[model samples]
Target: MKDLGMNLALSAEEKSLLELITPELVKIGKDRSKLIPILQLIQEKLAYLPGEAIHMVADHLSISPSEVYGVATFYNQFRFNPPGRNPVKVCLGTACHVKGGDIILENFERKLDIKEGQTTPDREFSIERVACVGCCALAPVTVVGQTVHGHMQPSKVEGLVLRARIEREKQQREKQKNESSE
Candidate 1:
């Protein structure tokens, strides 16, 4: 008898989504065949790939864990760590490159006091760079959460970040006020 490795149990929500994907995985035959979409599904369901889930998926599909890790690392869209409550992705694509993205990124690095791929000490923000966001015409653009600021200048970077911080503080204060009122 061959040991098939550890079996993974999914949470109720994850199981439901996996069941929906079971047909698709089955149709693909090998786990390798289903690997990408499977990963995507899990990421969508769980926000990030749990280590256990990755191992389970690898075992089920007869692939090595390293292979799974490799795939996960290769894709920028996929996040290995749980993203911050707010994730800031600065686009460094070619158009942005010429538009002083380097300076902007540096400013963020200095102001945030954290390198790229790092979250703030308080965990209120996480900074990262993307290859291209297709807003090159606006070059030197920064995306804070979902909002994008284009044509950014070196001098404007600090102000933009400060503005975002102030805005967030305002929202938090407003929420607190509402809670007290309630």
Candidate 2:
């Protein structure tokens, strides 16, 4: 995609959100001290900070792009990319590591063809590794959406992907059936 500068070819919804936030940004004014708050505000409003929003914030704050990105990256709470429909978090805590958590994470990455903290092209899945989830007994744990899979194996990742695909297909079929019935 070509560099879209401030607009970034944002969706209609994104544009509307930008318009709504623009006034607040003007109120906040350009201050280095306000950077984090601005980022948080944008994330809360847009779910994730889009490229255009970041640029707009940086421009409004009279800061460099690197400064904005640097601050955003420093905080784990900030998510640069949009989330997928399904958020999968793999635990990499000490217990999980002992149980081959890395193996499980790699399996998920290979299966989804996306690295940790990435969403798939179709936005069907996103997978990331967490330091700990306070469930050591559930070592090698994988959390897909709100469902926790304990004692997870690399093979289980395949089954999970397959199941998700099946479920999505089922939903799509049902929607199509309903449309045709109408």
Candidate 3:
């Protein structure tokens, strides 16, 4: 496979993941029509598509990296960056907007120190803006992972972030304890 010379770097874990998925990618076929399925497989394996993996897929299909990226970007299901342990989605639907959803979203940006569609440096949290969460009654809502939090306000941002941190810490500690027991 040819390198696109983008000089993208993959972490040890990412490299290992790519190695594991490469065989499947090849078996799926190298035709350009197979691009979407290949990309889907990669995302399913890695949770998000890494740049190195994108380039490798392009080479495998005898296409340019941009071609792969273009197709991937066209689909909303694809994500280029890694998702955080806690993914925060702010609803900006018409009802939520009227209830000050933008303000709530801004408060989260300030508290998290990361803009929409970006993950924190520590990877503990990621922020995204959603068109709607289908809960107009709870306008100005924020969903963290699978839980829907309603009637959110700017004042509640700090507490929400703090709670996520505490929960993440607890999970980490539990994971460590389990590993030690093993």
The TM-score values for the models, in the order shown, are 0.65, 0.88, 0.84
Q: What is the descending TM-score order?
A: 2, 3, 1
What is candidate 2's lDDT per residue for 42-159, written digit by digit as tens? 9999877778877898899888887888788778888765666788899999999999999999999999987786677677887778999888998989889888999999778999
Clashing pairs in 2: none
Which 10 consecutive residues of model 3 have the lowest summed lDDT? Answer: 1-10
Whole-model Cα lDDT of every candidate shown, in order: 0.73, 0.83, 0.84
Q: Which stretches of candidate 1 lie over 4 Å from their true place?
A: 1-32, 50-52, 55-64, 121-123, 134-137
Worst ten-residue run, lDDT, model 2? 1-10
Candidate 1 lDDT by residue in tens digits, 36-149: 888887788766665666776787799898888888778876765445556778888888887778888888888887667766655566778999988788888888888888
Off by over 4 Å in 3: 1-13, 173-182
Better of 2 and 3 by TM-score: 2
Q: Give the poorly placed runs of model 2, Cα more than 4 Å off.
A: 1-12
RMSD of 2: 3.5
In order, how many clashes per candidate? Answer: 0, 0, 0
